[model samples]
Target: MIIFGTALLAVCHLLGIFLGDLLGQALGVKTNVGGVGIAMLLLIFARIYMQRRNMLPKLTELGVEYWGALYIPVVVAMAAQQDMVSALRGGPVALLSAIAAVAVCACVIAVINRTERPQAQTDGAPILHDNPLLTEAE
Candidate 1:
């Protein structure tokens, strides 16, 4: 049950490390490439797949969720620390990738905001306007 989720996480992490190593070798680099991120994605997809197949046990799903929540923040902090250092020292490619990531995130946010704006405006809440005081003149 709970152990199954933990095992799944371990397998995902191992696969992530293997893939990261392969990616590094392919790119003539010497570091793990988004290993934690890949692992996280794998876990999420596995969970989704299992849920869709009605194969996920409730208690085990909760365990996975708890670990997933706990793991993400720690992984993100570690990744950010290492990425900032590497991006600073690794020259143009690293800088370009960081910039690209930012730009893509910005574009996605902008698109989401734009899509929601019209729906928000149409929410049926009455718009208030300044009410003038009643005057004697008819």
Candidate 2:
């Protein structure tokens, strides 16, 4: 089972790389970055879909939990990019702009949350099975 799963993952990765290369060529982007970005997006969507369908147990059975911790190193490496950090270290204008943008986003989120109506809930509800959107769709 582990061998089969590994083979399937390798195939999916190869497919992602091929598709990303084609996409990058069309968009004039570097193949390495585009391929990686595409693969990351595919993984994210797969995770979301699996979670929505309650496939966590299956993932755990496959020992996928260990692989989940691999993202920490990638995140740390991105934070270490000198050029990206330098670009953000401009004069007061850049600092103020970032602050203003964050403040605006916060205010917008707060206003939206305040104006939205709360959902109706029964006295006893199963947290896992209860979703307002799913009920409405039914």
Candidate 3:
């Protein structure tokens, strides 16, 4: 059932919050850092594990996918809540870290592209259609 998927998400979210809190305490921060990100990662791994073990039901998967679709917008909304001005005023550390993170992500993407097998080249011919409307006016 869809409720099962929601239950899984809630469980992961709780664990993520706990871990984030622990990490924050370790780093001497007062807030839960990366809790949402950790929860999303947990959700991904959980989905993958369930699929591999043939445990994910159609309804549950649909519920998970529905939430996944909202993930980006939700993240954007959360990020919008952050104090960008304060972060900038804090120092160049935030800026530098952001740049470094982007650079590392780019490099990783390039490496993955290089290592991935190339797809077979397709024929250049345009497909012919029986419908005259889909065909070019002769």
Ranking by TM-score: 3, 1, 2
Please give, for residues 1-138, the per-residue lDDT of candidate 1 as tens digits: 888888888888899889888888899999888778888999999999999999999988987898888889988898799779878889999988889999999999999988874544566656475445423332
Clashes per candidate (backbone, < 3 Å)? 0, 0, 0
- What residue runs in model 3 are displaced by over 4 Å at the alpha carbon? 119-138
Where is model 1 more than 4 Å wrong at Cα? 86-107, 113-138
Arrange candidates by lDDT, descending: 1, 3, 2
TM-score between model 3 and native: 0.69
> Which residue runs does candidate 2 get wrong by more than 4 Å?
1-12, 55-62, 71-138
Tell me each candidate's TM-score. Answer: 0.65, 0.40, 0.69
Which one wins by lDDT: 2 or 3? Answer: 3
Clashing pairs in 3: none
Error of 2 at 98 (Å): 15
Residue 117 CA displacement from its true place in model 2, Å: 16
Residue pairs whose backbone atoms clash in candidate 2: none
Could you give candidate 3's per-residue lDDT for residues 34-115 as a string of tens digits? 8878988999999999999999999999888878667758876768568576667869988888789889999999999999
RMSD to native for every prediction? 8.3, 10.3, 4.1
